[model samples]
Target: MQVIINGEVHDLEGQILLSELLERLDLKPGRIAIERNLEIVPKANWASTTISDGDRIEIVHFVGGG
Candidate 1:
């Protein structure tokens, strides 16, 4: 399956949970926010949210510097 992540195309083997996707990408869930298919998916829902082919996902990482 192919999904658009942060404006780039990524090929995934099959539909997976948002949480799994994050882990596969080596992303820290606590420090990131996700927007899937133009809708903001709450962190609480990450484990249940399913990512499918042609889905659009936007991941924003939080950085503390101050």
Candidate 2:
């Protein structure tokens, strides 16, 4: 399947869940925010959010530096 991630296109395997994608990107669920197809996916739904073809995902990582 094909999905647009952070403005880039990627070819992924079958039924890729949002949590799985976060793992692949080396992201920690508690430290980042994920928006799928214009909707914010709650933390509880990360594991259940399945990404499909043509879905647009925006992943933002939070960093602390001051």
Instruction: Name model 2 segments beyond 4 Å from true.
Output: 63-66
lDDT of 1 at 66: 81
- Report the lDDT of model 1 for residue 53: 94
Taken over the whole model, the C-alpha lDDT of each candidate is: 0.92, 0.89
Error of 1 at 8 (Å): 0.8
What's model 2's lDDT at 38? 91
What's model 1's TM-score? Answer: 0.88
Best by TM-score: 1
Q: Candidate 1 regions off by >4 Å?
A: 63-66
Model 2 residue 40 lDDT score: 94
lDDT of 1 by residue, 6-65 (tens): 999999996799999999999877767899999999999999999989999999986777
Best by lDDT: 1
Residue range with the least summed lDDT across 10 consecutive positions in model 1: 25-34
**Residue 23 error for model 2, in Å?**
1.0
